[model samples]
Target: MVRLRWYRAAPPPDLPVRQVHGFLFAPDGRAFLRVDGARHGLPGGKRELEDADPAATLRRETWEEVTLEIGAPRYLGYQLVVDGGTHRYAQVRMVALITRIHPVAPDLDNGRTYRRLLVDPRRVGDLLGWGRRGSRQAAAARQRAVVEFALPTLDLPPDGEV
Candidate 1:
C-alpha cells in the first residue's frame, strides 16, 4: 500500500526534491485538475534539468498539462509517498491561483492530450488517486488553501477569466 502524509513545513534542503504539485484554484475557488486514463489529480510533474526551480517546473508543467498560467505559488506542504516498506518519493505541494488559461496543447511528456477540468472544491476528493491515504488529506489541503491563500486574495483576479 502507498501512503501520503501531508505537512505544512517546507522540505529539508538536503533531500533532493523529486516533483512539484499544486492545488491550483480558479477565481471562483474551484481547483484545476487533469484527467489521465481513469484517474485525476492536481497538475504537476517531475523536475527537469532546465527547470530553474520548483516554481519554474510547476509553471511549465501547468502550461504543458493544462494550458493554464498560474501566479506566484504559495507553499502549501509536502507529501511523502511511501510504498510497501520503503519510501518512494517526496512531492512538494504548492497552491496557486489561476491567472490565465488557454486551449490546452498536447502534453510534452506523454505526447497525448489531456482534458482540463475546473472541479468544485467539494467534489475534488472524488478525483484523486487511491494511492494516497484518501480524499481526506486532499480535502483538508483544500480547506487550508482557502484559509491561507484563496480567501485572503479573493478580490484579485488575474489577466484572464478564471
Candidate 2:
C-alpha cells in the first residue's frame, strides 16, 4: 500500500528528496496547475544537479516546463511517500508567487507544452482529486500566499471567471 503523510516540517536529512512539487500562486490569488491530457497536477518536478536548493529546483522547473517565472518560494512541507512500510523518499512542496508569464512554448526538457490552468485555489483539491490531503494543502497555500506574497485571500467572480 502507498501512504502519503503530510508534514508542516521538512523531512529528515537522511531521506533523499526524490521530487519537488507544490502550489505556485499568482498575484491575482489563483494557483497554477499543469494540464497534461486529462491529468491535472501542480507545476514542479525532480531536482536537477545545478539546482542550488529546493526553491531553485521549483524556479527552474517552472520555467523549463511552462515558461513562467516565480518569486521567492516558501517551504511548506513535504509528502513522505511510503510503500509497504518502507520509507522511499521525500517529495518537497512549497508555495510561491508567479512573477512573470512568458509565451507558451515546448518544455526544454520534454519538448511538450502543457496547458496551464490558473484556477481558484478553492478548486485545486477537486481538480487534483486528492480529497482531504489536497484540500489541506490548498488552504495552507492560500494562507502562506497572503503572508509571503502579500496576495489577498482568494476572491473569484461569482460567475467563476478568473
Candidate 3:
C-alpha cells in the first residue's frame, strides 16, 4: 500500500491563530464556516497549520463546529498573515467535497455559533470586496488569494449553473 502523507508548517508567536482550517464545499455549492466568539470572526474561514496535522485539525474543527464528517481532503493552498504586529503564521487550507451536511444534533454547546450557507462562487467577489461585519481582515486576504489562484485554476462552469 502506498503511504499517504500531509504537509506541515510551524506557527508564529503571540496571537491565538488557527493552525489549520478545512474549507469544505458541498456538491450543491455550500461552504462551511464557523463564527469564533473569541476573535468575533469566522474560524474555519482562514486556513492555518496547528500543532497537530493540518488535515486532522480541519476534520476535527469541522466536526466540532459544524458536525460534518469530512472525507479525505485535498490540499488546496496556504495563507500567511501577520496580526497585532507581533504574531505571524501560515494557514494551510484543505478542500473536501461532501454529499450531505446536517446541522449539529442537540446543538452541542461548543461556545460558538456556526452557520452553513450556499454561496455562489461568482458572488464571492462582491462579498469579499464589500466585507461583512465581524469578518477578519486576515481571513479576507486569504480568501482573496483563494479566489484569485484556486478558483481560476479549477476552471469550473460559470455562475448560476455550478
Model 2: per-residue Cα lDDT at residue 129: 80
Model 2, 1-162: lDDT tens digits are 999988889899899887888698878778788888898888889998998899999998889888889888899999889978876888898998888889888989989879888877778878888889888887887788888888766465321211
Off by over 4 Å in 1: 1-3, 83-88, 131-136, 148-162
What is the Cα-based TM-score of model 2?
A: 0.91
Candidate 1 matches the true fold with a TM-score of 0.80
RMSD of each: 4.4, 2.1, 10.1
Per-residue lDDT of candidate 3, residues 15-100 (tens digit):
34455655555454444344333222222433335425567766666666667776666655444555665555566656665544
lDDT of 3: 0.47
Kindly report which residue stretches of model 3 are placed more than 4 angstroms away from their true locations once superposed. Answer: 1-18, 33-52, 84-86, 105-109, 128-162
Candidate 2: segments with Cα more than 4 A from true spot:
157-162
- Candidate 2: Cα lDDT at 35: 85
Local error of candidate 1 at 161, Å?
14
Best by TM-score: 2
lDDT of 2 at 104: 86
Clashes of 2: 0
